[model samples]
Target: MAWKKDDLFLFLFIFIIVSLYPCHGNFSQANNKQPNFRNASSFSTMPNSPYDYIVVGGGTAGCPLAATLSKNFRVLLLERGGSPYGNNNISRLENFHQTLAYSTPTSPVQRFLSTDGVFNHRARVLGGNTCINAGFYSRAEPSFVRNAGWDEVLVNESYQWVEDKIVFLKPAAPWQSAVKDGLLEVGVTPFNGYTYQHINGTKFGGSIFDNNGFRHTAADLLAAGNPPNLQVFIHAPVQKIVFDTRGTKPKAIGVIFNDENGNQHEAFIKTDEKSEVILTAGAIGTPQLLLLSGVGPKEDLQKLNITVILNNEHVGKDMADNPSNNILIITPEPQNQTLLQVVGITTKGFYVETSSGFGINNDSIVTVKNGNMSELKEIFRGGTILEKIIGPLSKGNLSLVNTNVTSNPTVTFNYFAEPEDLRRCVAGVSLLLEIAKTRPVKELMGNLSYTDEMLLNMSLNANINLIPKSGNETKSLPEFCKKSVTTLWHYHGGCIVGKVVDRDYKVIGVGNLRVGDSSWFDVSPGTNPQATVMMFGRMMGVKMIRERLSAG
Candidate 1:
């Protein structure tokens, strides 16, 4: 079969039309629960400045941590980005692609290209990555908790606290239903049904998107806490952590940040000995801030002319991004837009997921949001079968791009850098090809015919396909794994546990400073890390409260 120029033109026309009109199902009336967020530009001076706890980066973890701590202590949560409330792009599931397509200075997502030639985006909004990510929620594997040396009972309680406020349980949509059946057909596993617990089986996980198609982000968790004790400031990027060197060992006393207006402000800890400064600045921001504040490798700091405080060589090391590869299929009929819902957790070390009904226009050329025009790719439309390896063995390091804390650091996940990673990816792709032949998936694909040109052009659009006109699927798999590899945006590490931070999450040599986010994870938790990251915030907050009371 060959696609003529006329056929290609007709397909493009349909794609543009379908993209304009997104599927808007029944909209259920729901209450909007958010905190009273003030612009950092509003106040040049801090009101009741000295606080018991200062939580930087009011993201997926920061919001919950600050909210929980405020119940017993005065907490100030600083966010470099604006609030997610009232933003239609952030609130609606249908506008997911549009939100990512956004490329303004104040966009909810900030794009960055890894030195390894992979493009990725980091959340730049108060809700953190939850505002920009596919809203799948699942708890960490019990093994992850045990390995991290966390209290199992408290871990479950913290997970419940986060679920109660923000998580919603729902059945899969039409396309997702087909994917679920396809996975089962391919013998991915016994069906586990709806559960948030991470297990090796095909199951329906929890969603941050409710039944009404509204996305609930971590910022909403703030409403559950004591509001009087919590003060949230948006558009306030911390330049660095302020330290007092007069002590026998350097102590974190406060933080210096700039408002949206570029006005500098300093916030200090309260007189309480238990008061501390916490960093929830995600994987990248956490490490970048530490390095900028003269707390990284001595040689790197000396190169950058930064004063050396603690010569911890592991501050920005062991950065890992889950290597993701997928195949895109053009459906015969327009499908309803879906985010990640049903997932296939294979016995092997990879997870499978799917998303459908996202249409892209001719003008929608994708580029890194960091003003790099040379690296451009096309956004593919229609349904996709995506797989990402769990616990990628390969790792890389992050270094300073510049002294500016807002600028993205240079990072490379070195995807497939380890032989084990490639092996798992090849296995995952083999299973996906098998799943595509399943009855349920074939039915969803319909009588659609694609020519060699169509398949080749699809890859140009940054979508991978193992199926060829005629070739050995086995041999082509390794090449496909390398060429098609991209980020799942599930990156973690840098300020990792046991290396940079202790089991209690305190920076090894730094006093009164703690990290409580995915940055502390040695392994990316579960298939989706948001649930675990949110749970961690609540867990740490509870621990801090207990520690303070007992210490007194």
Candidate 2:
């Protein structure tokens, strides 16, 4: 996704403007508080003890995976970032943009600009992207589960497990309610009210935020686990997976990681041959670690001077991200702060979602008199209607920036690189444009008269002019898509299934090593992968527990 000048300005207004405020909000769910039995500690305080399972990365899937495994085995969960317990920016709905904007050397949100020149982020907190996302929680399509080789019954069970602890049925705010009505008004189909199911048509999905506007992250899922058996260490980053190469099949036995103070420690697995070292370090982090551990393409490892453990060519290939395009609807009326709750799922290969506030002060306004945009005092009161291309076919790759595990690897998603993907974007954007003109949505804007002709012509008073100038609407639409495309932050691939990992999520050609995160996804499950990813953690853990018990 390429960033345009206007997109940059819009992003800045949303993220950077209000970053100066300190985070402040209480967690609504009591489970969101770290439990007494959760042996969570900073890395310096952690002892180098052997564990039955060592799970690197305490983010979305990792936290739940580790928690579930602890039911019958000793588990150690290592996170590169601190806890999200008291971070108001991460927990409060109103501070959404500020949390993403408050980037620092050790901040929970790690900022990275892709090689394609589009800014992206990686979550460094215990809850992973759950700490920074818009909090929209929707399940994977049933077809997606079957295609991914997951048990359909188990998938539902796992989803219910996570929902019981964290997911909430969000009450639709006025703007979201209007947007839902607008989606129906535009033929998005029969409304599925307040559902977690990913289905066609308009519906209000689940959210991690409670009615009090406080977020409950995946970390809260740990409360369901046998806590006495789980040890969670924050600010502990694994440098590489230590392999025992003496056996016929190279086996992952331990991990070498560094503490917050830069002290190295080694954690090994117990004597049980089934013990494993799992990487739930997210899509980018998992692949990067594989490459750094000399588990990727041999030539790449040779250049990095890392000893080859396993030369897997598919480790960092086929990276994909959902290409997103959004238009800020600057309403004259004061709209309440909102995150993505109401979603419009289209049969046309994309999804539509709306959000009202991103921490932008409503009093602030931007006046543009340059080029195609008219001189209108656009207030940031109204939210944005974002279109995400479903199942983006355009793919790319991820490679090492350096040997440093913490540094972001170079990635290119090649958004709209596929002609089919471009077609989808055009279709999705056209639908979004129509939705904006619907009576229900327009009524919320309070007479912000904007017709298709005015919007396409880039009229000053049209209130939607993010597209670049072109002679015709068709030519301009594609150009707008290419330049204005941004990430929904739903990027996945890297260590995809069949190629990098097997159906069981175990790393190919290696023993006792597995990846259990979005990195295992060949296709992003639904509009949001968080729900499925959390479910995956639970399902896999349950499977492992059953396998272990059955063996005995």
Candidate 3:
């Protein structure tokens, strides 16, 4: 094997080229043109030119939808937050909590405690919640999507486009293995090997976290976007959708927005007939924007002084949050790190999952169940069994805090307000406790908190309301769950499919306007909805492309 001079030179040149690259070719190829992703000011000074499509809120759904739409159309994506690129807290798996704890008003994640005291954060950045969530990725159930009146073929096939761009297989570590074993031991049943499909019984799923522990999100999906067709303006929040009513009914013609500097600007639709304003803003932002733009319930808009364009009663009603409770198990030693790898999908109306290597530093702060901040205790270093119960009967609503776009929309998840919801929580906690008692998990788990009186009654705050009766309150699992149940941030169905948007994702009464996001759910999917949100984004992208071709 003699090396020729030309061959040696060629190898050296390619080696040098890769070495000069920032990520050693580890990231998506489209990421090399990162200059295309920029602050809002870049577009703010440009002369007025209407986009073929305008997507508001460059979060989970918005990014993918806009990126896909930009393939042939001139798409303008307005993101309220900065780029997720180069942010350590967002990219690293270890800083999962750090991103959430970044509580500054301008932080990418907008931390808020709901009226019921459940802690949650909304993504203020480009990838949306995908940039800050637990990074679990699972496809929506086929049955669920079919019932939503989606094109069954498109819905099933579109997930690969998203999975290819961002989703990764989470390798099960010791903790995850134990979790899988524990779930199987407790008869969660029918072990399906590692899969992306939403299946019943126990399984291992994918995540957005790469093997190197870097996050790949909707931002990465932009890598596939045609740079010239796509223009993303970060730190620019859409204030309201502007409508033109000279025709049969009002159509969203443009939008009013503010740059990072708080300077106001306007952008409009250009591709006539097909020109559209899509709200990929999440549950909160999507409904909030629609309501603010005078397309909500009649009485609510009148009270807020917003001129009603459409009297649709279903804009922001039927809001539901995926209720989740964390059961922490103290390990004899620091367990291996992993995301939601092993999970139990039970017929009992709940799903059990595990999170390891949360890796919070001792000095890092934690927001308690009561919304008070305190230095994180050492006990949080262990593994966690995070359980989310489906089909909660407790649905809440969101409306205008005021006409001000910047004002946070008044929100209430209304967690556990329904007796059925409380019952599900009790059942979920009991199942997890049963799993914890299994030999595999028992070796590592210790101490589930509950009050004896509360356990006997299976009621929350009934006999044990602020009484602090003895017998190690921390041992009562039911009480701890009741006091500390939080949202998985898997909120959906705000602008529901049937009531708000049709199967094509078009808003019922509005012209040239569509809503595609987690909020479009007829009912929330059983798994983490990031994959589903991305699926909707992908579907909208495909639909728009098909419509354009047909019109031509």
lDDT of each: 0.78, 0.78, 0.72
TM-score for candidate 3: 0.86
RMSD of 1: 6.7
Give me the runs in candidate 3 sitting further than 4 Å from their true place: 1-35, 360-376, 445-481
* lDDT head-to-head 2 vs 3, winner: 2
| Residue-wise C-alpha lDDT for candidate 2, range 1-552, written one tens digit per residue | 786766556455444222211111234555355743222335445564678899999888998899899999989888888878878888887777767755687898888877766667899988898888877788998889878777788888988888878888866789889888889998998998878898898988888878877888888877667867887887888999999899787889899888777888788997567999999999899999999998999998899899999988888899998887765565666677777888888999998888775555556443333223432234356666778888889999999989999898999888888999999988887887888888888887675665554444432122222334344543477766776666777889899888888888899889989999998777788888889899989999999999989998
Give the runs in model 2 whose Cα sits over 4 Å from its true position.
Answer: 1-27, 30-32, 36-48, 364-379, 451-475
Clashing pairs in 2: none
Please write out the lDDT profile of model 3 over residues 196-306, one tens digit for every residue.
887888998887777777777777777778888888888988889999988888898999988888888899997477889999889888999999999989999999789
Residue 533 C-alpha lDDT in model 2: 90
Steric collisions counted per model: 0, 0, 7
lDDT of 2 at 119: 68
| Residue 261 of model 3, lDDT score | 80
TM-scores, one per candidate: 0.88, 0.91, 0.86
Tell me the tens digit of each residue's lDDT in model 1 across 249-325: 77898999999888888889975557899999999999999999999999999998999989999999999988887
